[model samples]
Each structure stands twice: as structure tokens, then as C-alpha cells.
Target chain A: MKILVCIKQVPDLESRFKIAASGTWYAAEDLAWRLNEYDEYAVEEAVRLREASGEGELVVLSLGPERAGEAIRKALAMGADRGVHLLDPLSHDKDPRQIAGAIAEYARGEKFDVIFTGLQSQDRGSAQVGLLLAGLLALPAVTTIVAFSHEAGLVTVRRELEGGARAVVKVRLPALFTCQLGLNTPRYPTLPNIMKAKKKEVRTIAVTDLPQVAALVRTEKLAFPDKRGAGVVLEGATSEVADRLIAILKEKTTVLK
Target chain B: MKVLLVGEYRDGKILPSTYETVAFARKLGAAAALFLVADPSDLPRFAGKLYLAAAQQCGEYNPEGHLALLLQAVQAEEPDFIVFLHSAYGWDLAPRLALALDLPQISEVVALAEGAFVVPACNGKLRRTLRPLGQRAVLTLQSGAFNADGEPAGTPQVAPLTWAGSAVVELVGYEAASRGAVDLSRAEIIVSAGRGIGKPENLALIEGLATVLGGEVGASRPVVDAGWAPHERQVGSTGQTVAPKLYIACGISGAVQHLAGMKKSGFVVAINTDGDAPIGEVADVLVVADLKQFVPLLTGKLGGV
Candidate 1:
């Protein structure tokens, strides 16, 4: 089976975010950007499935500006055979529906037996695109998939449901699933493959050249949070600790109300 | 411009988050409107319009679908600003909508100012200011972000949204790898374990206390990644964001992402061998001890279920 894994480039979760003085957006002046933390599970799952079957190819896809090539290259080094980078100047600003639109249009013209993506992007974190993409493709869609199985052209997956419930369902080939973390510990790109990824090909396309997207229904101003007044720490022992803390807690959340 | 609180409903029923979103949205405006989108339902009773869409379930009390519909309505009937609670479906739906709409979106918004939205970023330690370049913005509100106006700020008015196709792709089936625990968010008191529990078998001790507390058991990424626990139980950036009234973390060093999800939790008590562990940094109370000995003693004292 051929596999296509979707990934996104985002600001590193550890770095501070700042809106530009102009107020257009977070100042990207010096912030670090990398593959979304969750997409790694998507890329990793594709690789693992390929390794387990030992007779398949993994093609990774991303939609973004020039630096997105770096993200795609990382996927290639992680064991994907090659990459396709959809170049959109505002890829960083594109909505999940629009982004999913581009991916679905491209997939319609490609040859992949299955598709995968992180359950959600760390930054944009809208986990909808994966399921929406499946809907567009008219394939079985599963959300928060932590386990999977593929055999004899049929696919089975488990979706995390509310209140500790789950729904295990199986669909045939050509399905889209959002991979949650712990589905696999994605491997970092190896040194040898890291060098090879530079030489390998990455297909880039213009966003305008792709399918047309509806007018963005909304716009956003990205901002970081204000600091919490220095946190209050309670000094105490183990047993009475719960009792004291419970008092403070009851004083805090609306859960008690 | 007035603040708009977006909500998801099916068959004319509103979820609790809708009320929560409305209550929160009212904070940013002198008066606010709570809007619901679905197949023309009983929205007149709510504070705003009832936008209709193709027949389907909006949310499972956690509606990514309803959020999509709400975004569509937000587009059709633009608001000065929109607010949503950052639950699982909200987290999955809101950010990209903000991105698609090119609107400035702040997720995990814990505080709001006239020109600035105070959000927890880089996890919880760092907070930054967001000034919307546009006329409006969308925010995924974190629990306990603000004190919602106690008094109703807006009168009820019905706004109608006609049916239409969703721009978002559809998800056919939501099958899980395994059945995990239900709504980890609603658990009022949470007993969470980390990789420090040593082994899956060790979870029995944690479960013992969880039973006593009448709460659910949550885990850190390591344990979930190790397959000792389901992904649903994992509480952190990659896992669920829980704002339980009382959070008891055992044998876990707090990573930024892990703290991002739970730090808003009302009161946190941490137990770890290293008294200076990162999780201990913000904990309301620190119990420095080996969980191995502590768990048995704690459970013995609390007694069995």
C-alpha cells in the first residue's frame, strides 16, 4: 500500500510568542519553527506501517511557504520516500478547511492507498481537517486514533470518544485517520537520511494554482497570554496536603458550584 | 461592536458549553449574543440567532461538527468578536477556523483586556499580549479564564441561518483503537499518574486512590506512549486539558505541555521524589516522597472502594 502523511510547520511550543509591533501577527522575527509535534505521530505511523508491511512507499505532504520544505525534508529523512510541498505564502495563516481542501484536491489526482495526519496541530490545533478531508474523499474517518490495523485491503481503527467511551470500526482501503500521540514514538531523522533528504526531490506547487478555496469566513489576531500573578505555593506534608489543597481548590474552580 | 458567543446544538438542544461560551463572551462586551447553528431549531430562547445547516449532529456534547457550523454562521453573520470554550472539539475546530478566516485567534485564552487578550502560551509560564489587527477576533477560551458576568448582559433575539453545505470535509466513522475512559474533562477530581509509576501494574495504587476520591485516573505522555494507558487518559499538550477542581499529580515531572493542559486546574498537589521537580514549581502543595510507599499508605488510609 502507498501511504501519504500530512504535516504542518509551526512555532516551537517552548518559545514565547509576540505580536508584531504592527499588530498584524506574532513577530516571527526570531521564533523557532518546526514540524507540528503531533504530525510526527502521523509521519511515524506511516513509516511503521510501511516497515511492518515491508513493501510500501510513504509520501509526505505539507502546505506552506519556503520553510515548509524544511518540514517536508524532515519527513523524508524520517523514512518517507519523497515529499510534496504545496507552496502557499500564507500557509501559516490558512484555515484547516482551506488547507484540507488543497490536500484533498491533490490526493484526488494522486495514487495513495491510505492517508494519515496528526489528530490536531499544536499551534492551529483544529483537528477538523483530517476528518473533513476524509469526508471530502468520502472515506471512513476516524478521530483520535491511537491504534490501527491494515490487512487484506481493509482498515480498522479505534476512536477516542467522550467519557471514556470508544467506537471500534473497520473500513476498507482509502481512509483518513488522525493519529494521536503515543500511537508511536516518532523517530528523529537519522544522520545518513538527513543528508540524503537534501538530494531527494520535493515537489512544490503554488497555492493559487491549486483548487479554489472559498473566501476565508474569518480572520484572527494571534496573541500570547498575560502572566499569572506569581503562583501561590502551599508548604505542607503528604497526608494533610490533600486537605489543605482541597480547601484552596474549592475556593478556585466553578466545579464545586 | 458586540461580542458573539458561538454555540453548537442538534435538534434544538444547546450543550452546556454554549451557556459557558455565552457567559464568557459577555465579559468582553457590555452586552453579548449567544448564537446557535443547526437545522432551524429552538434558538429564539437563546440569546441570539439559530443558523440552520445540513441535518446532522452538531457535537457529541463536544461538537467539532457544530463548531464548523458555528464558524460558517460567524462568517455569514460577522460579529465584532467570537468566543468558544477550548474543549477537545473546540481545540480541534476553532484555531483553523481562525486561520482560514485570517482572523487573529488566541487559544487557551485565560484573561481578556480591551486591547489585549491574555493567553497562556509556551505552555503556562509565559503569557503574551495579542492585539488584533483586524476588526474582530476569535478565541478558544480556557476554563477559568475570566469571571463571566453574573447578570445576563443581552436580551434574546432570533437570527436565522439558512441551510448550506459545509466547507469542511466530513468524517465518516470515529472508531477508536480501544475504548478509553469517558470525558476526562468533566472529572471534578483527577488522580493522574506519570511515567514514574514504574509499570502498568503500579497503576493499581493510583487507581485505588482515584476510586476513593470518586474521580478518574489520568496519565502523562510517557505512560500513554508506553501503551500502559489509553491516549484518552493522557493529560498534557498532546493529551486532554483538564480543569478539575482538585488535581493530584503523582511521580510526574511537569513538562510545559503537560502543565499547559492542567495548570488551570483549581488546586494542584504534586508528589515526586525530587522536591524541586518542575511540576512542583506551581503546585499549591508539594508532597516530596516516593510514590511507591506513598501510594500504599495513602490508599490504606483512604481505605478501599
Candidate 2:
């Protein structure tokens, strides 16, 4: 009952973002890096499954520059048995397919019984890698999973759909599920675990070891999203704000007007 | 240019997002065809030809079977561009299809201009104009970013196709969230609450306002994730895309994902304590006040009026 979880390091969403001089990506020098929110659930789920079964080697895999090792170590502190870091210096701008292909290259040899990933990376927001990796691996793939249960080499997951519809699916072993929020609350790593994680070795694999794939999408330029318009701000006390809002709704907009 | 628009349908109804994607494909002024993966019943006369891949497995919306079916169709009917709605299904399928076909793929496109695409990155704080460097490109159009009124006036051709693939997964059942029969997408007026509402009990003020305004209650993702509201009442990229006539957002600081769902509303009113909240930029009426204090006042005043 071996399980693999794919995690990525991302900048904290609350941080102020600055466009790089290249006008293509955000400047990373001053940003605070943390584990991606969705992948936190993925790692938590993997750790819980391992704890429940009381058997199985839980491997946390991440692909990025050296900074991503921090995220891998966090997963280790969260109770993963080992970590595999696919190290690549020029990995930031690669598209999802290329990233998934590199992962498949490494994953094909390991043959874990099940794989888990975040529904989408916070940075790309393409929601592509998990499904693409599943496709490349030719395994059963489910996305936006909120609830999961496992027994007897069979896994059942509840997936979140558009319009808030939910579907329960069952898949055989050697499957892949991309987790969404509300699946489980991630636990903070204790000081002892953090010390233990620091001692744990993370095996590094160079991206050059894998087949090179070119990016499909080319970014020409990046700019701030155009502001819609100047909104009339109602200030002062609570009553005044409420009064102004209601007055505008009744006088300017169609609501109540 | 030849465009292959992959259409999605569910529960015996064609998704309106497909029409919006078609509307975008029409902007390319290409010879477009919609490849539908559903029962070919009541097929709307789209602006272009329609091809149906009514495979049994595809009926339930599994990505594996749909990918294989669409791959088969793409090989047979090669097009310069492949378009899909950037909905739940599209986000899952486009990358794999592009990889298998060795084509370029872009997601969540808001605009197409002069062979370049406008897409959001860095959590929608920045927009990037991208170009496909491949011979053919697969794209997913952002929902509500395009016009839905571009279906041609004349009848289009319908061609039946077959898919030969196996589903690696099986759908056991579906459980619709209990949302008190409130479909936020169809609601004309929506009063949505955010985390600023503080607690689950504080939702009564929001509901009270909606009740008096004769509208439905929607919520931000945090509120829904916290169990203050059902997922069905959530409005966001992962929840529901809505274009209500009037949207009153209470305490929502405006995460880009949440704004993606309601930015198209006819009118927007935002209430939050922070004047610098991103919601202030998009809202037509910005009330910079604490939602806990402001909601009750607004509800009470509206009630008396």
C-alpha cells in the first residue's frame, strides 16, 4: 500500500506581488514561500491514510528549484516517510504538460499504488498537472475531490463539480485523485518532527535526467488587470455607509430603484 | 482557420458555457464545429456544424473516456484551434489532450486578439498576453468572459460520431448539496456574505437583507468552506459563475476566484472595513465599514423602507 503525493511550493497569496523586470512573471526575491494550500491537503490525506493502515511507504514528490526542498521537508515533518525532489533551475515557467511529463518520467519507474495531487497550483491555476499526469500514466484520475475513503484496494472519492454538484466515484488501485479544500485540515509540524524532518534526507533528481519537453504557450507580456472603474466610496460611520449604500441602490442602480 | 469547439452537456441539458465558448470561437471568424459528448437530442442550431460523440461512458462525464473520444475526433477532423469552456471539465481535460496531441494549450483565456490571448496569472492579479508557438492550439475559454449571443441565425449540420475507449473509474452516485432550493446562478439579485461576516450565526443578517430584497443568498468560498453555507450557495471559480442583476457583497475582500464568478453582474455593491480591499475596485458602490455592524443597519433600514 505505497502512496505518492505531489506537492509544490508557492508564494503566500496574501503577499504583495510585483511583476519582474522581464514583464513575464512575478519577482521572487522578496516573496515568502510556503506549501501550496491545496497540496497541504494532499499531503495530509496521504499521512492520514498511512497512519490508518499502519503500513506503507509514503513518498512526497516535488518538482522545482532548490527552494522547493523546503516544502518537501514540511511534508516530511507532517509524517511522510521519504521525499523526492526533482531539481531543475529553469523550472519556474514550464507549462503544466511539461512538468507532468517530467514527473511521469520519474513516476513510471516507482509504480506506487496510488497518487495524490492538489486540484490546482495556486500560481498557475491551470488545474492541469494532476489530470495530465494521470493521462500520461494511463491511470484512473479524479479531480476536485473533497472526501475520500479506501478499503480492499478500492478507493471511493467525492468530487466537487460546477454549480456545487457532488459525485461519488469508485476506482481501483493505482489511481490518482486531485484534492480540493475541505478534504481535511492540515496539521502544523511539531518542533520534534521538524527536527526529525531536517535529519531526513531528500533525494534530489536533476531535471536534465528526464526527457526535455518544450513549452506550448508563450507569454508575450504581463500587466496588471485593467481596473473596471472608479467606485464611489462611502465613508464615515457605519450608519452613514449603510445609508449611502442604500441610497445609491435605490437611486442609481436597478436594485430597489 | 478551422476551429474545433468541444461542447459539454450534463443532465440532459446543453451547458450554456459551451455556447459562450462557441461565441468566442466565432470571434476568430473561422470555420468552427462543435464536438459534443452527449446524447444528440434537442441540439441547438449552433453557428457551426455539430458532431456528437454519444458514447455510453461519456454520458457520465469521465475525463478518460471524453479525452479519448475527443482525441479520436481531433485526429479525424484536424483544426487549427481546439476550444473548451474553462469549467470544471475543461480544466481537467485540456492539458492531457494537448500533451497527447503534442499541441499548445492555454487555460482561462479572457480575450483573443490578433492571434494572442489574454489570461490571468498570479491569482488573477496580473494579466498575460500569450501566443501559441505550436502549429495548433488547444484553449479553454474563461466562463462569462465572452458573449453568449453569437449562435448563428441559420440551421447548422449535425454529424454523429462514435468513441471507443474504456473508463478507468466509475461513478457510484451523485449527492446534490442541500441549498434550500436556491440556485444562485438564476437569481436576479444576490446578497453574498464573506468571511468578514465573522461567524456562522452572523449569516442571519445577510439572509435577512436578501429576504427583504426578494433575492437569494450566496457566499464566498471561505464562508462555504467554514460550513456557514452549503457549497451550492458559494460563488467563485470553483463554485458557481453568476451574472445577477444586482450583487451586494458583504465583507468579501474579493479574492480573484470569487470575483471571477460575479464580476459580470449588472451592478455590484461591496461592504468591507478595509477601503483597500480589491472588491472596492470592482464594486459600483463601495461601503467601507465593518460588515458585522453595517449589515444590520442596511438590513434594518431596507426593512423599514
Candidate 3:
């Protein structure tokens, strides 16, 4: 009944982002960091599964810079038994293959029954690592699962599809799942739990110590997307704004006319 | 370079994105072939070779089974690249095929640059150009990014492949989304709400505006996930891709997923407190105001229509 959950630290969605000087990624300084929203749901689901089983160990893992350890600690506070941090200063530069290869290298020997990860990270948004890790390990995998149930070593999951459709899939243990939004409500760490989590052991492994995998994809440049057009902005009193909007809709588009 | 396009077959028909993938391959100006894992019934008239695998052995949408068939196709065709639509099927299968073949993989490519691929990141605020270092790669094109127009008019050579692998996962069934009554795709006008609406009760303001405008109500993923709106009314990558005549987004800070659904609307309007919201990038009109006061006033003004 052992379970492993992979989490990532990303810039808070509300943070104002600035392009770095290199023009390959966002600036690292003056940014607030938090656990990726989707990964939080994965941690909550793993915590609930371990609690229901009443005996199994729940391990949390993260592959990112030093700040990612904070995300692991948050998961620990939420209810994981331990944490594993694959520390890399330049993790943001690594592509999905390199990231998944590092995780696969660490988890190869650990025979966990199930592995969980967010459907995608908020920053990269590639949505490739979990399935890539599963492929590297030769384990069956499902993505964007919103509903999950387990019994007798068989796991059934309802994965989200386009247009709000759900596909039910069943796979045996030694599998992987990418948790999506609306999967569950994550719990906030209370004071006592936060204090207790301070004692939890978090093993650190330098990503350099792991087998190096060459990045297949490289970022050539990063920039703000081109604006579609110069949009007319309306402001002032609500009544005046409403009047202007109506006039524009009638003149600019056919829907109102 | 040679290319392979994987077509997604679901619920007895091929998806439109399959042809869109063809449009992508044609953009590369390379020899291409199409692959599908289904019974040979009225196949598409691809200009290149078409590879078909029986659904009985592949089990229609099983990752391992499809991977096995695709692997065989790759061995035979020796394509330099494989392409798929960024649909649920492609999102699930492309990475598996990449890792199994030990090739680099890129997902959700929105545009093709001179020699790189452009992808949206950070909720569509940023775009990154990615170049593959490997000679071969797997790519999933963003849906609707490529248009299938003026398709080839000739039939393709059919090549049947066999799958001998065992299934690793079972396809149990599918649960239809609740409240299928609202079809936003057919609506001429859509008035959508987002988290800025504040609470479930605030949905009334959105509905009132929609009614006054003679349009259907739409919602962002957050609004739907919060249970403020039904799944059918959700508009986004995972919800619905719509191209209405007029799309008025009230309080919706457009996430990339949400923008993907409605970016094709003829005219876009966004009302949000933050003028810099991503929705403003695609909007024709940006109204910077609190939705609480603005929506009611707008609805009252439009009531005479």
C-alpha cells in the first residue's frame, strides 16, 4: 500500500511576472513561490489514501531548485510520512525528458504500489513528465484523473476528457496517475501539524549525483505573446460605461444589431 | 524528412483535430503518412499512405496497445517525426510513444516558427520557442491552431498493421457530463462569468446579462469547478471550444485554457477589475470595473434591446 506523490513549486499565479535578461525564462528574484495548485490536490488524495489504509507509508518527492523543499514540507505538513527532494539549481532549464529521467532514476528501485503527480506544472505546463516517467518505468498510467477509487489492489479512475466527458479506466497496482483540478479539496496545515512536520525526515539527493540525461528540447526564447489588437478601454461611472458598451456593440459587431 | 500523423478515432468516428494534424504535417512540406487504430471502414482519403490497425486487438484507446501498433508503424515508415492533436487521446498517448521510442517529445505546440515550435506557458501570458535537439521527436499540436482546408482529393495507399501486445489497462466505460442541455458552440452570443463574480449567488448577475443580450450563459473553469455553473456551460480547453459571434467575459481573467475555447469569437469583450488580465490581450473591448455594479448596469441598459 505504499504511495509516492510528486509535487512542484511554481510562482504564485497572482505574482507579476517579468522576463529575465536571458529571454529564456521568467525572472527568479522578487517572486512569491507556492506549491503548484494541481499538485496540492495530488498530495491531498495521497494523504487520504494512506489514512484509509491505516498502515502504508506516503512519501512526497519534488524535483526543483532549493525553494522546492518548501513545497515538500508543505506536503509533509498535510500528512505525508517523509519527503525526498531532488535538488537542482537549474531545474527550471531542464526539459520534461530530463526531469522525468531524474525521477525515474530515483524511483527505479523503490517498488511503490502507486505513483501520483499533477497533470501539469503551472510554469512549464508541458503535461508530459508523469506519463513520461510511467513510460520510463514501464508502468501503466492515466492522466487528468478527477475521480479515483481503490480496492483489492485494483485502482479505478475517471479521467477527464474534452467537452467535460469522463472516461473510466481500471488498472492494477504499480501504476501512475496525474491528478487534475476539482479532484478534491486540499486541507490547510494547522499549527500543530505544521509543528509536527518540522520533525519529518526529508532526504536530499543532488540531481548531479543521478544519471544525467541530455535534454531533448531546448528553449530558444521566451517572450510576451503578441497582443491581438489595441482594444478600446471603457471606464468611469457604471451607467456611462454601460451606455458606451451598448453603443460599441451595436456599431462594431453584428450580435447586438 | 518523413512524418507520421496519428489520427484519433473515438465513439465510431475520427475527430476533426485529426485533419488539423494533417494540416500541420503539410505545413512541414515533408512526406507524411496517417495512422489510425480502428476497423477499416470508410477510411479518410489521405494524400499519403494510411496505416490502419484493427480495433479488436488494440481495444480502441488503450495506450499500450496503441503504442505497440505505432511502434510497428514507425519501424516500417522510419518517420523523422510523429504528430498528434493535443486532445485527451494524444495527451495520454504521445508521451508514452516518445519514451518507448527514446525520442524527445513536445506537447501543445501552438505555432511553427522558422526552425522552432512556439508554445504558450504561464497561462498564455508567455510564449516560448522550443527546438528539438534530437533528429526525431514527437509533437502534439494545439487544437484549432492549424486549419484543415483544401484537403487532398485523392485516396491513399492503405497499410494494415497488427498489434500483438497485451493490454495493461482496461477501458471500463464512460460517464457523460451532466447537464448536456447547454450547447455553447451553437450560441451566437455568450456571456461568461469567472471567479471575480465572487460567489455562487453572483451567477444571477451573469444570467441576467445573458438574458438581456439574448445569449446563452457561459463560465470559466473556476466558476464551474466551484459549482457556480454546470459543466455544460463551462468554456475552456477541458470544457468547450466555442466560436460565438460575440463573447462578453465578465470578471474572467482569461487563463490560456479558457482563451483557447473562445479566442475564435468574432468579437471579444472582457470586464475585469484588472485591465492587464490575459483576457484583455484577446479582447476587442476592455472594461475595467467591478462586475457587481457593471453587470447590473449593463444588463439594464441592454434590457431595451
**TM-score of every prediction relative to native:** 0.62, 0.88, 0.95
Name the better of 1 and 3 by TM-score. Answer: 3
TM-score of candidate 1 relative to the true fold: 0.62
Ranking by lDDT: 3, 2, 1
Candidate 3 stretches greater than 4 Å from native: A235-239, A255-257, B303-305
lDDT of 1 by residue, B27-133 (tens): 65535656555444444345555454434443233234555556666766677777776654555456545654656566666666566666543334344445555
Q: Which rank order by TM-score, best down to worst?
A: 3, 2, 1
Model 2 RMSD vs true structure: 3.3
What's the distance in Å from true for residue B102, model 1? 5.7
lDDT of 3 by residue, A125-205 (tens): 889999988988878899999999999889999988876778899999889999999998889999999999999999999
Docking class of 2: medium
**lDDT, residue B213, model 2:** 93
Where does candidate 2 stray beyond 4 Å? A190-192, A233-247, A254-257, B150-154, B181-190, B196-217, B237-246, B255-257, B264-266, B272-281, B287-305
Worst 10-residue lDDT window, candidate 2 chain B: B147-156
DockQ of 3: 0.68
Error of 2 at A11 (Å): 2.0
